[model samples]
Target: MKILVLAIDRDDDFGVKAGVKGPVIGRDSCLDAAVKLSLADPEDSDANTLFAAIKLYDELKKKGEFDEVEVALITGHPNVGVESDLRLSKQLDEVLKKFPADGVIPVTDGAEDEQIFPIITSKVPIISTRRVVVKQSPGIETTWYIIVRYLKEMMSDPEVSKVVLGIPGLIVLLYGIAKIISIKYPPSAQIVSSTVTGVVMLIVGGYFFSKGFRLKPITSLVRIVSRGLITFIGVVTGFIVMLGGAINVYLTLESIAENMIGGIPTSELIAFLIYLNAFNKYFILGLGIMISGKIIQEYLRRDPHIWYYIASFLMLPAFWKVIDLMTIYSNPLIKKSPETLIAGVLLVLIDLTLSIIISIKLREEVKKWSSASS
Candidate 1:
């Protein structure tokens, strides 16, 4: 039986740091790759994994348990996803072609590298696996160094930094703005402070919500912008409009706060209704604009989802009317009538009926589009 000791570098640290391309086959080649990698980055664990593979190869050869023992090193792309796995697969295939082994002993630095085990197992039976963990000094300095290094890495990663630093920085900036506004207008200080606190809580909650679901808004935005100029403009304009709407609500609330003689329940309720009315108007308009752009883009691309966008667009007016009615009914000071309620209900029913008809009419087309896509 022949055994091949395979070492993996899933992130291509060797190539990125030491300018060494893999598959580094044979004992001497593996040793050279390991030495060069270690010399390039003293802290990289891939070098230790390569050295472990070499040591394992020697031990197995010495034991005389196999007909032949060989060692090889394979490096992957830095992206560490499908691209990295593809590269690693190609390198592993190249190594196997050079040395046909009965079984493989996969050696990896950590779980990241171990992810390619299935790729290896598909080609050759796994005799065993070895995970090489470089033991570190248990000292205060070492612990502090590791902590600082990871913190720096987290700061460098865009996704991690957005939640860790960006959100907090934004919250601080908002607080400062609120402080300045309070100084300029003393009567609205309490309202501004409360609003800012609410905003902060919202930001924190949103961050956790996105994180929990692994939603990558930044990535999705980038993808959208890359789709075309029209889509990009629509998204940007919609967001700007929405932001303006939010500012409008804040200013209107501040003005209302200033005019209120006392913080009474009825006044608070009325103020909240006004805020909702403002939000509904701008938010719906912004969403409509954004969806319009998406509709145009999808229509041009001949995407089946355009029908869904059209349905949503048609429904927005009805949504707005419903919210308007709610605000009107909830406001104790505002005069409400049966005619207004009837009008709103009729408008909603019309919109719903039209949307449902459109969807039903396009259902067959949607199915055909989906089949073509598949």
Candidate 2:
């Protein structure tokens, strides 16, 4: 069996900064690049990665661990996130065709490089991953310098800056705009706030425009967020439905009060009471829809933990009904009438039945969905 000693550069910094292009193959090529980079920039992590990879290759060669073993060094596209990783993955695949291996020992210096773990694992089994860390003793000045450098870089990089500044910047802009639009608030405050907000936005936008022109894991994160938003919309819609039902309940209560003052018949009064008590059916339906939506989201995502959510949500209506019974006993208005209790029981039963039916239907739907997706 062939074994590979794989080295990765997720950001192609080796190529961009060190002038070391990849896929650099074989023990000699990998070692030469490592030595050159280490000499050029001692602080560069890529240099350390290369040194570790070359050492691993030499040791295995000296020991004769396997009959057929090969080492490879690959760098990704510059600036781009997951796209850079994708570039690395594609290059690795091509290199494998030339020197095919069964498994790999990946050498990475830190977590940034290791983020490509999934990409590598898909192509070849990882026997073990090696991480090489450089130790340093820094003076106070050096420590301060490092912190300052990091902050400068963070300000320069839009990917980092967006998270740090986006929310606050947007809030300031919105607040300023609201002030500008309002006739009641002081014009001086509005002008000051808007000017400050505009300046912040300009700085942020400039940084983003500068950096983003050059920039994907970012793309993956975006997609994940999009899915979460869709699920959230479903849950929010369910709540809105229930809110409408609550408004109806308030209106119904008002009508009941009017009837009490107008000397309405006893039969009509009982009917109105029944209708008032039954207003909760919409709430129950809304909750069921929300749970169903959550379950569907998990199921569609193929998450293995969805069963736990489903099981709990399935019993939610019954649990709520029990809580309601306890609440009703404490209330004097409904405690005297057994009809409300009977109605509650029937509604609870109906909800459970509907929940079961929907659960069964969703199971079938999920199965079909799984089959289609596969």
- In candidate 1, position 82 carries an lDDT of 100
List candidate 1 stretches off by more than 4 Å: 137-177, 186-188, 198-374
lDDT of 2 by residue, 242-274 (tens): 888877766676565444334332465454454
lDDT of 1 by residue, 1-374 (tens): 98999998898999999999988999999899889989999888788889999999999989998998999989999887899999999998998898999999999866667778989989999989998877783243334546876798888999788877898899999999999999999999999999999999987897798889988788888887787667788878999999999888877775643443233325666778767876888889999999898889988888877788888888998999999888878776666789989989999999999988987777678879779878
Give me the candidate number with maximum TM-score: 1
- Cα lDDT for residue 248, candidate 2: 79
Against the unseen true structure, what C-alpha lDDT does each candidate score? 0.85, 0.74
What C-alpha lDDT, on a 0 to 100 scale, does residue 165 get in candidate 1?
82
The reply for model 2, stretches above 4 Å from the true place, is 137-374
List TM-score per model, in order. 0.45, 0.40
